[model samples]
Each structure stands twice: as structure tokens, then as C-alpha cells.
Target: MVATFGEVVYESSRAFADDEEEECEAQTGLSFEVEHTSVAKSLLEKGSPAAGLVFCAFVGKVAVGFGDGFVNNKSGFDLLAEVCMVGQGENVVDIYLNRPKKKVVAQLYYGAKDKNNPVIFALFNTHGVPRFLANEIVSKVTEFIEVSNRILIFHSDTLAYYQSDERCEGKVFYVASSKYSRANIPSTAVPLAPPNVIGGIGAGVLMHGEMMDKPALLLANYGENELVDSISLQPFAAIVKQGAPDPSSFSLSQIFKQLELTISQSLKSNVNPVAISNLYI
Candidate 1:
């Protein structure tokens, strides 16, 4: 079934009691239900289109799954949970069991270079799970950008930098609002003059110099921090230095393969599966 933007859905918990077989069956058999919350709906309705749409599920205070995209749908939740389960360190039980108030399970951000650009999504974690999965995504995206013919760093709120490489003359190009100035560039990094033209979109885009085909990478950052965290950037740099997949096409399966994520169990399961590809947005 489909869901509107900001709608919340619930699935039966896998946890069950030893002596309550019938009760467990009843709980497991229950259909997913929408949770009605005025505040959540309001926030979603008012959220910026640039920020994309977010759908999240919580068991008490712990977020079990979350997804983000330009549009909202039920399948995104399943995708979120599938991605959440990909890595080691923290299992599902540990995530749900040790619920702390206001703790986030995962945060997914979807950004597009323009109406025509392919949508790109990034997932962030609050606790428990190691950052290997996030790192893998960053690595793949970084490789794409490095090999592309032209690189543009898109930003809405403030100026951000993409690490320079041989393809771009080891120089940084700016893509920010007209108000952007040299003062906005942080002191820790070498300051380059802002680009003459403000980027039309929020996510960074890489294009072939002659052919304006599909972008090599589309990137967006969401958080309180003014800059994209080093945790996400470091791995991307490491992978690019080691060399990465050629920038011919982008595929979710290829990324999963690169990360060594097993999909058989995820595919077979009804509750949590890789449903990101099915998303309309």
C-alpha cells in the first residue's frame, strides 16, 4: 500500500514470549498501521523541498528504520530498515532494547542537482552500528566525482568545499548564494574565491566536460554542523586514493556488492527488505 508524505507506519515486533505462542502469532499477523500525529504531519508539510522527505519508525524512543527521498511512500521504510541491518556491531535487538530518549535510529537525506538530476541519498546513524556502510556510500560517491569531467559544489545555507584532485586542477570551485564571501570560508582550509555564478541546486554535481549526461555524483548534507563531517569524508578520500569503480553508471546492487552486504535474507523477508529501488522519488 502507498502512504502520503510524512505518514508513519508500524510493523509487528519480532520479539515474543515463550509461553504465548498464540499471542505472538496474533501480533505478527497484524497489518501495518498508520500512526497519526499532528505535530509530525505539520513538520513534514512545512519542510523544505530541498531537504527532501523523511519517513521514520520508532519503537519507543529508538528509531528502528528511516528513509528520505524527494517523495514519500511505504516502501521507503522497508528500504531504511534493510540498509540499517546491513552492517555489524549493533543488531536490531540492541538498537530497540537500549532506547534512549530523543535518540535517532538513522537519518536519510535525499538531494538532487535539479529536476533532471538523479536523486542521491545519504544515511547517518546516531549510535550502535559501525559507520562502515555510510563510509562505503561516501567512498563510491567520491570516486564518481573525482573521475567526472566537471565538478560543482552546490550549497544553499553556506559555502562548502570538495577536496581538490588532478581532474579539477586541484582548485576548489564555489556554488553558493550571491551573499557568499571570503569570510564564509573557514580558516582551517585554504580560501578560494567563490564561483561567479550561484549553483541552481543544493546537491553537488559532476558532469563530463563535453557530454552533459548523467552526473557522476549528487551529494547533500543534513545536520547541525556547518560542514560535512570528517567521518564521511575520510573514507571517500581513502577509496579514491586506492582507485574505485569507473564512472560509467550508478547502481544500487553494485554499491551493495562493493560493501559486501548480503541481500538474500533481506530479499526473502517480508518485514525488512531492500525497497529503495521501488521508491517513486
Candidate 2:
């Protein structure tokens, strides 16, 4: 699936500070302050793992542009679209509906705990589904499955490019299978170190299990000159472990304080900065 994302990178602890900073700037209208903060004492410290974990939730509407739908293995036809949002918040929502003209979709939430959980989110087709009926399906999914906070757009991008429907294709179907792969890691297994995929920290997290057999550290997983979008990545474990100057002396509360302030301030000024999910996925 094709997914595009945007994010505002900021010091989570200074969210509110960023807000004040913006207000101060707007009031003064001074372009004097450097666009980027480089002071080590300030919360804008880069590459800090503890600084990265606070992804909060903000509500917004998604516009589903008209597009082709995908064919499914089931008796009925289905549509799929690829969408994603990489914001510095705990919750994100996906809005979907049969009729794009009439905005219809659901909200999904994510938090620090699931930082490393590979499953992004899941949703079912609810096109033509009544409001009450649609809600019931959503409720069931939330109750039974994790990542309920994530919004799932039914008939999304995956359906948009189905080759068979217009091509007189036959239906695709799913059958029960007792076969299992021995390589499958149990859900409880600790995630292996992240792989060094260029421009793919998120994807690396998503595919952690499969790539565990490989080295977890970027120095080992990636070659010297991999071309990733301007991310200055070091080894994953090293980064996480080296959160603060003194590895032995670290606190979650301190990190939270820094993140919360950063988000409020930066976002209040319409900056909408993105914070790294401190998740160790």
C-alpha cells in the first residue's frame, strides 16, 4: 500500500514552551530567533529516545478523494485506499465512507505502550452500513483487538487498484489453514533490534519480527552509504539505551514533562511538530 506522511519534529517537553515561543514571536514578529534550536540545555535536544516516546492524540478530518476500488475474495466487491498520518500524538483517526461527499470514517488512538507493536491498525468495510450497524462493528473490533484507537478506512486504497473487477476477474477467497511456520515468533517474544532500512524507521518497526534474524544495530544492518530521507540514525539499541547523558540516571516523568510542554507550545502556534514515539518496538 502507498502511504504518505508528514510530521512536526519538536521537543515534547517544551510543547507549551514552543507555544509561548510562538506567541512571543508573533507578538514581537521577530525573525531573529533561529528557525531551529540548537541549545543542548533546551528540550530541543535531538536523538534523545526518552524525548521521542510521547506521541499524543489530535483530532482531524480526512478527505477521501474519489478513486477506484479493489476487488476482494468475498462475494461482494470492496474498495481500499492507502492513507497514513505521522504526527506527534497519542491518537490518530482514519475517516472513511462509501460516499466521500458525505464524510464518514472512524477514529483510532495510539499510545507509548504500543510504540513497538507492529500492527499499525485494522478496519473493515462499512460502506452502505447504517450508522448503528457501523458503530457495532467498530465496537466489536475495539473490544477484541488492540490498536482500537487507530481509525480504519474501509474500501480504502487496496481496493482502488484491483485488477480483476473491471477486467472480468474472479473473486479472491480465503480458506482455513492448519499449516503454520515454525519461524513465527510468539507474540510475547521480545522484539529483535530494528533493521536499518533507509527512510523506514516505521517500516523497520513494522517488520521487526521477520528481520530479527539479521543484526539489530544500524551499523550492522545498513551499509555505509544507504540513501534515506535526511534522518541521522545511529544504532537502534544504542540510541534507546543512550537516552540521556548518564544511562543509569534517567526518569520517565522528566521526559514526559519535557514532551508535554513542547507539544502544547509548538502546536498551539500551528507549528504541529512531530515527536518520535518513545516506543521500543
Models, CA RMSD each: 20.0, 24.0
What is the TM-score of candidate 1? 0.19
lDDT string for model 1 (33-138, tens) is 1122332222222222221111111111011123322134322224333333322221111111121123333232222223112122222232222222222222
Backbone clashes in model 1: 0
Q: Which candidate leads the pack in lDDT?
A: 1
Weakest ten-residue segment in model 1 by summed lDDT: 53-62
Per-model TM-score, in order, reads 0.19, 0.19
Global fold similarity of model 2 (TM-score): 0.19
Model 1 pairs in collision: none
Give the per-residue lDDT of model 2 (tens digit) for 118-150. Answer: 122223333333322332334343332222122
